[model samples]
Target chain A: MSILTALARLLIFPGILFAVPAAWFFLWVERKSVAMMQGRIGPPFMQPFFDFIKLLGKSTPQRTGVAGALMRAWPLIAVSTAAGAVGLLPVLPSSGGFQGDLILLLALLEVPSICIIAAGFTSRSIFGEIGSAREAVLSVSYNVVFLLAIISVAASQHTFRLEALAQAPATSLRWIGILAVLICLPAKLHLNPFSLPNAEQEIYSGPMVEFAGPELAMWELSHGLEWVAATGLVATLIAPQMAFWGLSALAFVALSFGIVLLLSALAAATARLAIDTTVRFYWQCTIIFAVLAVSSALLMRLRS
Target chain B: MNLWKRLMCYCRRRSPWLFHLNSGSCNGCDIEIVAALAPRYDAEQLGVRLEGSPRHADILCVTGPVTRNAVCAIKTVYGQVCGPKAVVAIGSCPATTNVFIDSRTLDGPLGKHIPVDVFVPGCPPRPDAIIEGVAKAAQILAERGDEVPEVITAAEVQA
Candidate 1:
């Protein structure tokens, strides 16, 4: 690919253009689905966009520059990295993806979380620090499961390239790896039971409590992007082969919505777990599921 | 309104995230606010979310008669809310000090300490009324924009 073509593909297609809208759609689905399950009529279709606009127009609290500038830029960094990950991932069988992009994606996924931690510490607020600490702990706990799940997929498919992963055969061992990915995802997404880091009741929204206006807008937008990227990652990992690109994309949307439904259902079904219990659950339940998945793949490989 | 103001009006009025504060209320008005937010009343349809932090909030929903002890915190909290914001005084107490007027320890009638843009008058206002109050506050915020004045400070109240 020529430089301009590659730049155009990266910048226009999967970069901000594709990632932003897809992220917003995921957020809309999340809100609408959660409200439906709760028997409420939810916000209008453009609510998230409206929120972003309002935040853009709203005034931010005064803080001195350079340090404040960098502190406030975390959300920007986060959303960009997430969108960049989406740009790297293949959405269809024939979609072009950069070589050895899997490792880059894995690194990109961690950037948002790291941003959260960094944003928390930079604020100099005790609650932000506490929230950051909890987030750090959660990250340590879930990283094992998340990495293992990814490794399972990589090992099962025999290549770390996303294009190959999408076209990879859907064997029984791969299904187990998919389950491993599914079970470990809630922590990454900051959904309920594992959503303690931002618990309003406990810590006043933790790190982002002090974020107002455009800062908070970016935070919300980043989470939205993370949802799209994470769900797309899962969809590409498990999607069945289709003859048409549109059919596969629809399948991806349906699969992501299914994931959202499961997410909200989990939110409704469980209370927030305490810090220790959350760690224990990841290490015990989530990790065990991941370990089982990897062992099954290994066991199958040995038999062959 | 021009295109820019119109857009801001739509966005600000449509998505009014609220931060609820109780200035020594009997918990009645607070409960009503919760009722308004719950699934049945579902103020969420209008995008009226109850946010945890004042920083992220566009509307401040103040309940009960402002008490002597709650004054400073109220001032601080109200100040913490970023601009293009409005305050909805829920229940009769914050409006006129209601039945608590004769109490020596009382410091309210909420307007003495801060600006109130809307008032929903009931001992404990209904969820519908509370929702309307918030919506009214949202409208006030949308139209007023950057021209909205600072909330009355504690020093000014003493003067």
Candidate 2:
């Protein structure tokens, strides 16, 4: 057997197992962090896992809907896609230059968001419709910044490979791009101030209102993975020096978990923004930062 | 795994799930409860989930002063819940009827209609306080007695 294939299988199994606990940990961290921000004690770090277990043990309510099958499929798709995205990440790369293809990573990252929207649509509840629409809007809104940042990263590295971007020498202008990425990170993770699509108060948990029992648990699991994957991406881009196979993997997980906690703190301290306000904030304020970061990267390249 | 269970216990301590019922109020406290869920208060981060149905909920959060029209619906919902339930009266109106106390159509001081475990005193309590109250309710639910309270009010039967 080829060494790469054997290694890939080994890595993928651990990666999938890591995903389950990572997601559970994120849920606990999100709660604790948000509580700290509000001057309140948050739930224990194991809360999400117990909640999932409890839900699994509980009986699922049968709902009358044509979208039942789709709803059932969505969470599975979301979690698997999120896992795939994690696999493609350069957590433990044998070589320095672009571990997994960047284009592939980006596409995989977008899958969970799309599946969430589909789950919402299948439910056919008003809240589900609202959630689906909001999720769609969020996807479109963030993609703009995501695409721009990806383009800038590729332009600087002269390749659309993650490892190459990592291997590229750190330039002062990369900070600007990183800043843009930072802003996009919270939105991608569905943290507050930017958490419109699943605003529980406004539309009864947006897309997840109708989901109960195991289905809800799956969505929750995927959410935790999303946090891990998103933060892992950021850590990789910024801290490329830590790219050794095992150590990089460990560092990537630790750093990403820390970021999720920080964002959770911010979410607890803040309030939800009006949908209109969030859209503008992402498009105008956030996009400006991204553009500036890319421009700076370009300037640095010219100087070199 | 044991560590996770402990952490979950801690999370449940901070972020309590709230099942909000509109027991015929002016929508003021309801709005405030919702405000607690918004980003400004963002209770969800602390693990405070808002449940639509009472059966799956740990805390039964009732708003309004208990209008005559809503008493029956409230009783029915309160009965539907399993043991280890907690009732949180979200406004002064429900606690003592506040300004709406004198209305002949009102039938409240919610405790008279249902066993209220926690009273979140406010014309409309601040979102943070509401979050605190729900946390208290969750604790109560965890320690509640095994016997379910029987329906005692005449108003409960008519509705």
Candidate 3:
């Protein structure tokens, strides 16, 4: 097969197909796993798909005083970015991974966060504004930790290529890199304990308060994909020795998703930390872990 | 197709989303509703989602007797919920206004505002009873048609 033909095949078919289902399944796993940890039977494995279908069929209510066109289009932008980020990650065996730079991939994930904040702010509702503010605070708190963790991984592996990071040796120092990655995982997934922005009890679903119908479904799909991408990054970094082909990626995805579920359950079983407390916890707690991991990586590099 | 519809009706009978409306209640029943979602009684496992908006909801779980001031809000919320909906009069207050029956501010015994599908009798019904009431409401929802019964009047019930 010609290189150009193979590249074209990779970009269009597997890249798009891999993202939608992977994202949906990851969401299902998170819900079921959290339910199991809490000692309850969670929603069915296909619940997210069913929910998206149902939401799509419902009426889309426009918020009073918001610019109609902007509100309608924001979710599309968010979902597109989320899907784009999936391409940047090495979830599928196909090629075209270089369509995104490392910084571009990170920015793609942030697009949804920005859209969430914008949606909330545009709604002209008090709850919407408060939710947007909380989301802003959360973004500020975690953005640095996420960047530092990613930088640590890049520095240790000596390449910004996600595939290269996955192929890097699993040395003792890699364990530290693993810890830094783990701390950033919940932040990226928007799971419990780290779920300050969209706290259902406090802000009535935060930025999602006014969202309904197909717009809500798109946002939900993006969220599901974000969960997949975050967990996939962790699995790829920690256990690259696992095969990267079809079912091997599936197995690694499942294992990583299970780990995230256990963590979410732990978060749910515990009471919510105050916003200030959460901010303090992420900055202080994550920084300590990241620094230790980086130091270990440096020591290993010198010894080698 | 017939069997599938019947099975869906059966599942809907067992599970109903309870859309709680405060309508000036003292929040006693609200706490009970929350208790129903906790681990011991977890209604979520049964497919009972406590949705925020009335439009997306299936069952209207009204708490407290209707105060004169809140009567309009209650009616508005009830109207907003789509068809095939059921009204559950949660707590004794909404059912009869209970201790507040004599208050000048009360226009209640919630049946005055909307059709009451199932009456859960308690000052604040236990979480188990709330679950049972929700199940009953779901059954009513599945069976509802264009020929919904006329609103039951207080005078007719007393007679």
Candidate 4:
């Protein structure tokens, strides 16, 4: 790819410009859908945008030292990396991606969690420490299933290029792999039944307990981008190949919103789980789905 | 005002996350607060969310009369919330100390401790009333966007 094309891909379409707006829209969908499920009129369509602006307008308390600098960097790193991950999506056909882009995408997606865990520890607040610890444990437990699911899909397709995977035909193994990925989504997005790390009722936003004003806004933005990246991955997997760029982009967004609605339903229906129960559940699913996915991929490979 | 400033004010009015602080009420006002947030009243329609941390709150909702034990806590939480914030004194307790006016363990009327922007008066105000109070506070927050935040100082906390 040419430098201009790469720059355009990274800074504009499917990147920061696209992801930021989509992030807010996804957040609105989650909140609005949950509100509807509870029989209430949710906030106006622009509520998330309003929130982001309000937070930015608020004053931030000063924290003087090394910890303060690290605290500021955490959210910035998270938002930038998450936006970068979103940019890796092959939303347009002939987007020109290279070999093993899937692995790079996965790495970019993990950066926000790493930043959250670090933010929790760096805050030095008791609640932040506890939240950080829970986040660390949860990340370790869920990533096993998460990574295995993606890797299984890649193995079945016989390629680690996301564009090739997107173009590949779906298989029974791929569907099962997608199911495993779906199971990991709630934990990754910190939604209900697995919202331990930032349980507002219990930990008051965990690693974000100390963050306020602009910094808090950044974290919120990072979270919104995460919703975009994770759901976008699933959307890419499920979305049918399109002949034109406009149709492909539209289909990709529609699929992502559908996933958002499905996840919102799941979130609204369930209650938060205990930390031990969540970890145990992920480990059990990891064992069960890992076996099924791996063996099925091997069998498919052998058949070919 | 410039467009950016106007946008800030508009956004501040549109989204008001609340942090509930019970200074010593008998949980009556607290229950009413929850009722306001519940689906029946659905304060979220007006962009009011019950936040866990004061840092994220745009409005500090203080219920009940301030008890001596809760005085410092109220001060600390008030200090924790970022600027462009408002305080809503819910129920008659926080506004006038109500029936606890003579109690030795009481230290409020919340206004004596922190500046209050709105007050919803009742022994335990209804859900609708609480929502109205919050909405009023949100408006106040919008106007206060450029003003300096008034926090209780270390000496005030020590006092």
Candidate 5:
């Protein structure tokens, strides 16, 4: 393929244009589902889109020097990196990804969390600092399981390419690895039970306490992109590949929406756990899932 | 560009995230404000969300009589919210200092501190009433000009 086609693939399909809108849709699904579960009427379908627009239209406060520049840059970095991760998703099986792209996707996916941490500290607010500290700790704790889960799945499939992973047959080991990944999603997305980093009641939006107007809008957009990228990864692995690109893309979106509903139920049903409790819970799951993943991969290798 | 501007105005009306501030209320108006956002009332259907931080809020809902102690805090919070914002004074206390009109500790009638766009009457207004007030404030926000309205208190009006 020429560089133009590659650019089209990266900048159009499964990229910023597609991912940003899908992110808004998924966010709406999450909110609407949670509201239904709680017996309340949620906002309209266009609520998230409207919110983004309203925020962009509002006037922002002035800031000076390095802190201001970094604050402005962090959300852009987050948005670009997350969109890149989503772009790397094997939504269409024949999209043509290179070898070891799974690792590149993982690295890209991790950039948002890093950006959030840096953004919090850069804001120089006490709540932002506290949020940054909590995010730092939680990122470390959950990534142990997150990394191991993806690695074990890769080991079972015997390939590090995302397209190959999507095309590979699902084994019991792969399912277990996927289960481990699901456990990490709540913490990563800042949903209930693992939402300590941005506990709005206690810390006042934590890292985002100081952000307003277009800057905050960028952060919100980046968050929505993260929803797309993370869930899209899980969806790609579990969704069955089809002979046609169109069918594969449809299945990919449908499965991702299903995961969003499942996650919304979990978020609505649970309460925020204490930071210590959340850390302990993730470590325990890591140990159990680690054993299952490692043992299952070893079994697969031994059988082969 | 005109269409874009109009669309923005439409969006501003549609989504109004609120930050609730209690200058010194008796908790009656506070409960009513909560009730407005509760399941039965569901202000969220109108895209009215209760935000935690002032910076993220488009509407500031001030409850209760402005007490002497809360005066500074209220000003600080009002300053934090981004522009193109609206203020809704909930309950009669914020509008006229209510029954505590003679209370020495109070420095209220919220309009004295910040410009208020909407006032919901009643000592402790009903949930429906509070929601209506918020919706009205959101409308004001959508059409509001870039300039924050100059606050003219009763004393100033009399003068």
Candidate 6:
């Protein structure tokens, strides 16, 4: 494929357009699953889409000048970064970007959280500040364990390219590493047990407390993208590799949806972890899992 | 303009986030509102969420008669909701000041201060009635083209 097609693919297919709809679908999946978990019929499947429309159509709210600028920038920044990262994964394994590709992917994923932190601080709402501080501390708590988990994925392969992982058979140790990464997924997505930053019952929207109208639409639209990114990352790392894999986008999508369901069930079943407890749990338990996965990866390597 | 109008109507009808205000209720109606969101009612299943901030809400579900101090807060919160919004007065007190009518501190019958689009009227309306009022408000909100809120009569609500 030429540069133009690749650019087109990145800009159109699986870009904002594809990613946006998929994101919306994933959000519907989330709410529906949570509703089912709580024994309710849940919103119409179009709830997420309707929410985006309603927010966009409403009048915009006010914020200070600099804060306003940043708030406006945040959703665009968040959604685009996540969508761009999705492009790199190339739904087709044949059209893939190579090893150490994951490093770029990892960096891209971090941008959204950083933008959220910036949004919380820049918006100047009290809850926004509290949320920003929470996100900052939470990121600190999870970054090392998350990084180690990523490194373990790399350790299982000879090359550092993300594409290699799709083709690399999943080993028991690698699965252990993936499971270790899965433990961090809830925190990464701010689902239950780690949903501290925006604990609705406790803080009433945290960083997003002050945002309204189109600004909030963008905030939520980016959230859909983030959900896709989270599940996509997990799917990429763990999807089974067979001769004709990645050809069936449907299967991979189903894989992601299953992961979303798992995460949502986990989120709905648990309460938000307190800040200190979140930090401690990440430090103690997840860290141990990461160390265990990494050591086992090394042990397997030495044996080979 | 036409497409925008349709999108507004359809989307507003599909999702209506609410903000609750307890004017001066005995907490009976307040608890019922909470009950509407509990497992049996689970208003969220129908796309009605209880929002923390007024700015995020499409419906203001206010319970109780208006109190002297709460009257100002109620209006302020109503103004804060992004438009094409609706207000559902959750109890008889908010509808007609209920038993608090003779109380000196009362300033309720919520419509006097803020136009109430719907009223769920029992001293403490059932959770189902509260759900109906909110749902009714969502429909009214979707159809509003700057329509002024007129109080729904007791007869109309019962019908």
What is the TM-score of each predicted model, taking all chains together? 0.93, 0.73, 0.81, 0.96, 0.96, 0.92
Q: Tens-digit lDDT track for model 3 on A165-193?
A: 66678766667766776776666566777
Q: Model 4's A-chain: what TM-score?
A: 0.96
Model 2 segments more than 4 A misplaced: A1-14, A95-99, A242-246, A292-304, B1-16, B25-59, B62-68, B71-159
Relative to the real complex, the DockQ score for model 2 comes to 0.13
Best by DockQ: 5
| C-alpha lDDT of residue B125 in model 4 | 86
DockQ (CA atoms), all models: 0.82, 0.13, 0.24, 0.78, 0.86, 0.71
* DockQ winner, 1 or 5: 5
Indicate the residue-level lDDT of A151 in model 3.
73
Model 1 TM-score on a 0 to 1 scale: 0.93
Give chain A TM for each model in order. Answer: 0.92, 0.90, 0.86, 0.96, 0.96, 0.92
Estimate, for each residue in A1-304, the C-alpha lDDT of model 5 and write its tens digit. 3566556657887887788899899889888988898899888999999999999988878999999989889998999899889888877644343532899999999999999999999999999999999999999999989988999999898888887898899988899899999999999999998998899999998999899988888998988999999999999999987988788888888988888899989999999999999899888756589668977897888899
User: Per-residue alpha-carbon lDDT of model 6 for A1-304, expressed as tens digits?
Assistant: 5576577657765567678888889888888888888888887878898999998878766656776788889978987888888776645545533322788888888898998888888877788899889999999989888888878778867656776777688777677777877888888788888988887777778887777888888888888887887778778777766556445466668778899989999988998778999999989888997888777767767887
- Ranked by TM-score, top first: 5, 4, 1, 6, 3, 2
lDDT (10s digit) by residue, model 1, range B1-159? 789889999899999999999999999999999998898899999988888889999988898788899999899999999998888888889888998897998988998888878878887888998887777778788878887666642111100
lDDT of 1 at A205: 86
Pairs that collide, model 3 = none
The digit string of per-residue lDDT tens for model 4 on A1-304 reads 5667777777887788889999999999999998999998888899999999999988888898999899989999999999999988888765343422999999999999999999999999899999999999999999999998888899999989988999999988999999999999999999998999998988888999999989999999999999999999999999999888889899989999999999989999999999999999989856589668978897888999
Residue A245 CA displacement from its true place in model 4, Å: 1.2
> What TM value does model 5 have?
0.96
Q: lDDT of all predictions, in order shown?
A: 0.82, 0.72, 0.71, 0.88, 0.87, 0.80
Candidate 5, residue A203: how far the Cα is off, in Å: 0.7
Model 1: residue A228 alpha-carbon error in angstroms: 0.2
Candidate 1: what lDDT? 0.82
Cα misplacement distance, residue B76 of candidate 3 (Å):
5.3
